[model samples]
Target chain A: MIQFRPIYVICLREFKKFFREKSRLLGTLARPVLWLFVVGNGMNSLIRPQVGFSYLQFIFPGMIGMTILFSSIFSSISIVWDREFGFMKEMLVAPISRVSIVIGKAISGTFISVAQAVIIMVLIPFLGIHLTVLQFIEVVLVSILVSFCITSLGILIAARLTSFDGFNIIMNFLVMPMLFLSGAMYPVTSLPTALRYLTHVNPLTYGIDAFKHVLLRNSAPPLGPEFPLAVDLLVVTILAFIMIILAALSFRQKE
Target chain B: MSIISVNNLTKKFKTLTAVDGVSFSVNEGEVFGFLGPNGAGKTTTINILCTLHLPTGGEASIAGYDCVKRPDEVRSSIGLIFQDTTLDTGLTAYENLKFHAYLYNLDRKLTEKRIDEMLSVVELTNRKHDLIKNFSGGMKRRLEIARGLLHYPRVLFLDEPTLGLDPQTRNTIWDFITTLRKQEKITVFMTTHYMEEAENCDRIAIMDHGKIIALDTPENLKRLVHGDTIHLVTEDNEKACAEIAKTFDILCHAENGGLFIETEKGEEFIPRLIHSLSIQVKSVNLRKPTLNDVFLKLTGRTIRDDVLSDDKEVTREFVRSHRRAQR
Candidate 1:
């Protein structure tokens, strides 16, 4: 039988480590809070109020995306750290399958990312973004799906990197473009033809679009393509699965 | 029964061959030692037996399972202590052991018992709850040994377990390992460059240039030197060497401005050499053969000579940095 105990143990250790480091927890929270209150309010005055909702309420879902993206990617950097410090050798020499290690790491990264996103979730009332109970549940579900996909992506990147500096440079290179092209800061409908195509291709675009769909379905205008809710769920679920499989394959190649 | 059987195993990395076609078998419950200088394929062989690296040729089996084909079985049957520190320093001693137990699928109740038992064995029970980052080098090594044995593996592979430790710490580490062997009856396959440490093993394979130059019990391997070695400093060293060689029909050579001879009775030869030489003997020293002598007799050089000139250390660092760019 395939044992899940190892997976659970690894995830539990990650959670313990995450909680013990107070500075890291503060850092995870600080970035999103800054973007929500300072950057959102700053940008609100410059952009025309085309969307029915205010800028702070409109960009709330984007802050959640930002939190998930940065936290998951940062958490996955531990893989490279483990390898450099020789702890990776200990985990690899264990009796369990390499796939278990990868899954364990992905799960831990997902949990941490979701936890950071929930910190933003508490700002709903403060930011004046109204949501029904059903809408709140949908928003949470989409956030989880997005977290899983992004964390899996982080694992996939981390499996191939051996140095923390290399991982940081690559994460910044990929994350900046992903966030910028994701339509998280602005509406996709207002983008030029070339930029609009880029938004369509970026997976984060679908995630943020899904978040906006669930959180502001009644209060705000649609940002981009009005795909059905089912399409967003389907795309996110498939992307998460594919990224997980890729991450597992990358780990297997190490042997 | 033999716990490990390796047949002409080989491992090559691009242009460099780290392990050549080499073979050796370790009997069950035997403390088998691979004595070699650094880069003599000791670590590579251990890595293959532990299923960490794929062999380029030949085969190896641990607990009757092929290392390459049935890696999971091989892995489950073996515990490994790497040359470098592999413990998670950020985690506490107990947490490290707990992680290993869960990975091996040990029962929850049994895992707790084993963790406590191992901590006591290594004498780290008092520090079990403390983070490993604060541990001394000796303490971390003790914890690693405890972690390695937690799963009750049939075989344990220790790669240079006491590489950089002080003499006292090295002895204590070996003491724990010896105690573990008597209590658990697990096979130990370890690699080391320290000649005196290799004496603790039941049998040792002296390796050089990726090949086993000598394999036997410590006593028998020492016997390979043939007899006690006598070092003589004479007024005429060259003449003394020729006289000893001619009269005793034994090989004698000039080393360090002195005459050296290997003979059955070093003391008996000393008197005859002084009487027969017709030259004044300044000094005579006789000593029994050691593992260092055995290495010198077989390879014509000390193990330290090879270690000093080894470029593998530089290559290892280069490889680490290179792996980063390759990704």
Candidate 2:
């Protein structure tokens, strides 16, 4: 019998490579824990919500979005490492199509990011931010979209990066700022006018808004706040597809 | 018939022309060496043959298909061991091979069988389960070899295959490569800076500054410069060089403050040269000229000093220069 070979092969290879490091697993959990247990309770004692839904409930969806965002972006760093270790050269020269290589890396990166989200999902009951049966399914769907978008961006950045260290520099520069600006840790309305405009430019903003709409009762998601849900997803998907094409084209063997 | 052929292939990056109007072909089941010092575009030529990079000018076809248009078919026929050691440290030797096998969409039963054979060839069967992070540099290199051979490619591209390994490991690796070539009847194309490695090939192409200096069997290449070589030691090298350049029509090269010359008339010319120079000769030994002499004659230098990457040789910039220096 034939097997679902390449996909399963890439997925298995990526999973072990990522989970091989224990701290990666811990880091994924630590951020969501701090937001749900420490920051949520900290904000409860600090700012009173208008609906009185408590900060623990308010930050849960944001923390999930934060986990997906950080994990997705940081996964891009593996591309830099692969280049440094010479594995990328091997991949570039493999018999498979360059498009398949891009898909393999994107699928692997998104899969890992989604898994991190799953770990946080397991802790929802302990933190008292429970998801109803319907909300649970929506969480899965949103995770997939956020995973695909961030993973695509990750591959795009990797395709352009030259040095092994520059990937970490990107994480420090763009990922942290984007995470904070996306309203992942707090409500968007509380921010200044110009900051709200900046949120419109962030992909995570749409991800979090959709997430909070389904998860947090007190937060108003304002359906497709950044752009229409279909339109924004189509834009991100198109951007991702274009990048995939570029990454494949960049694999042109040098003479 | 030629198994691989390229006609007037030229590749340029920005302002620099790394390979200019170079053309050569490898016959079926023959061992070919692309011999050149670093930055001579040896790697670039191999990359093009492996279908990793595109050629800017000219055309290269492998096994009768265009490399650029039919890359999948070309890649399927050739396995590449990059000059840089590119093994995945996170995976074990087995996993690396398995991953490559899957890349080619190998049948499960056949892949397992081939993986077993490759592990035995590299002599790493016992270490199959250990993470590649724990492998010695030589072991990692061997792992790369096995991975390249996983899909049973008809041709193997080994760029500086033994570079950076210890002599003992290098010998073992070479034996393994030679054995693989014989057993599989695979055409092996390699590039290296070492004279001996080039000599071992059935034929070699000496490349300099992105140009092919000469292409022939090692013995024939050595024959082109001289029938016999004579070594001369003298501190008055420039004067001796001038005198020899004037008196006899022969090739002379300087190395470590000594003059090596190739001429059948060494004994007859020796007395005249000594008398003309009027200097004490430290020593003189006659032997055959080598590919080193051929390279010096074509490139005019024993080394390419212009390609050194200043201070960023070990940084992420190393990768940048690895590409940028092609220009």
Per TM-score, the best of the predicted structures is 1
Let me know the TM-score candidate 1 reaches against the reference structure: 0.90
What CAPRI class is candidate 1? acceptable
Q: Tell me how candidate 2 scores on lDDT.
A: 0.76
In candidate 2, stretches whose alpha carbon ends up further than 4 angstroms from where it belongs are A1-4, A218-255, B235-256, B265-278, B285-287, B303-327
Cα error, residue B116 of model 1, in Å, equals 1.4
Q: What are the models' TM-scores? A: 0.90, 0.88
Q: Global lDDT of each model?
A: 0.84, 0.76
Chain B TM-score (each prediction, in order): 0.91, 0.87
Candidate that would win on lDDT: 1
Evaluate every candidate with DockQ and list the scores.
Answer: 0.47, 0.53
Which residue pairs collide, candidate 1? none
Model 1 stretches with alpha carbons more than 4 Å out: A219-227, B229-287, B315-327
Interface RMSD of every predicted model, in angstroms: 2.6, 3.3
Error of 1 at B258 (Å): 8.1
lDDT of 1 by residue, B16-84 (tens): 676778888999999999998777778878877887778889999999999999988888898888888
